[model samples]
Target: MTTHRRLVLALQPDMLAICRLEPTAYIGNDVLNGNFVAITKTDEELSIICPQENMPEEAIYTKGWRCLRIEGPFSHDTSGILASVLAPLAEAHLSVFTATTFDTGHVLVKEENLNRAIQILTQTGHVVRSENKATVPYAIQ
Candidate 1:
């Protein structure tokens, strides 16, 4: 088995929501203004990840997810960054929703699982830091 390098991840401050809309549903301005938003449209659905407060009432959504952003502007050729983080979480039986930007990867775990997820990541040698004071107590040494 290959050993992936340890990484530092930043926990974003907002509580996000994941929404599913009809394949051709219109994405409004509310979602566009979020601190972090990801939208994807496929033949079956239009999926949106954004701050909970910005989600549209008509969309079917799951709320109270917290995002962990892998710190990087990694070169396109770089590999294993996300797997390293995800493998550990999967082993612990945690479900995650993931998204990737050109620069980094984001993992969203339900709010209730946030502390345990951070602990698991830290145990596996990854560092998770948060600017949100609410998460400060859970930061592992």
Candidate 2:
């Protein structure tokens, strides 16, 4: 079996809800449903937002936020901290949203799952801090 090297990076404690939204120059913003959304351009290349189901299977979920950045001194294979953080939520049947920048990994859980996610992360030895509103820890989910 080939073992993949885990990237080392810092994570912050900020659980944000990944809201697939329709934000327009005309209407400003319209909140889409919980899971996924798709945007397409018309004949003139005009962008339009639509529910994800209507799009092709190849469509990917865009918009990454409502996540806590796992803080640094990161060495991927060190102790499996990353996996520790993710594993519990998966077992809890909560969906996780994630993205990786060159510097760190962002783990996004649902807004409703924010508290439980933080609790799980803390219980597992990973540190976390909610953004100022410290209670819920994210924008509208």
Candidate 3:
């Protein structure tokens, strides 16, 4: 049986820009001080980015990108929220990445469409919270 708990939509402050730099995307020293980019040491070559003044010297190649996120206080059994969120993004032809903490779940969309995604979430009755703020308690995945 599925369980129901509260879920909210959240996002990081800056937009995430992604780059695929062979197998060595994020190995070198960060040229931009704390520019908020991540190069995953994964089997795949990928790095998600935010706005950085000093971009990499090696030409950063990007195939395509989208803003991705689902914020916390969400429920697995919530009838419409997940469906509601994903449906529209799906319709808009966007992809998503998801992570979970102790109390909530997180979804990540591309950086460009975050504003639109937040607008949709708010208009549909989900509350967005800042990292340092308090949002509702959700039993998330």
Best by TM-score: 1
TM-score of each: 0.91, 0.46, 0.50
- Please provide, for model 2 over 1-141, each residue's C-alpha lDDT reduced to its tens digit, 9 standing for 90 to 100: 212333322333332222232333231233243232223343433232223233223333432234565655555546554566667667677788665444445666655666677666555455555444333322333
lDDT of candidate 1 over 31-52, digit per residue (tens) = 8876789999999999999999
Worst 10 residues of 3 by lDDT: 132-141
The true-versus-predicted C-alpha distance at residue 117 of model 3, in Å, is: 1.0
> Candidate 2, after superposition: displacement of residue 4 in Å?
18
Candidate 3, residues 1-141: lDDT per residue as tens digits? 222323455444544444545665554555344424444446656454433443465637442233323554555564554565666556667676544444444466655555566565555566655444554232111
C-alpha RMSD of each candidate structure in angstroms: 2.6, 9.9, 7.5
Residue 136 of model 3: what lDDT? 26
Off by over 4 Å in 2: 1-65, 73-81, 131-141
Candidate with maximal lDDT: 1
Displacement of residue 27 (Cα, Å) in model 2 is 17
**Candidate 1 least-lDDT 10 residues:** 132-141
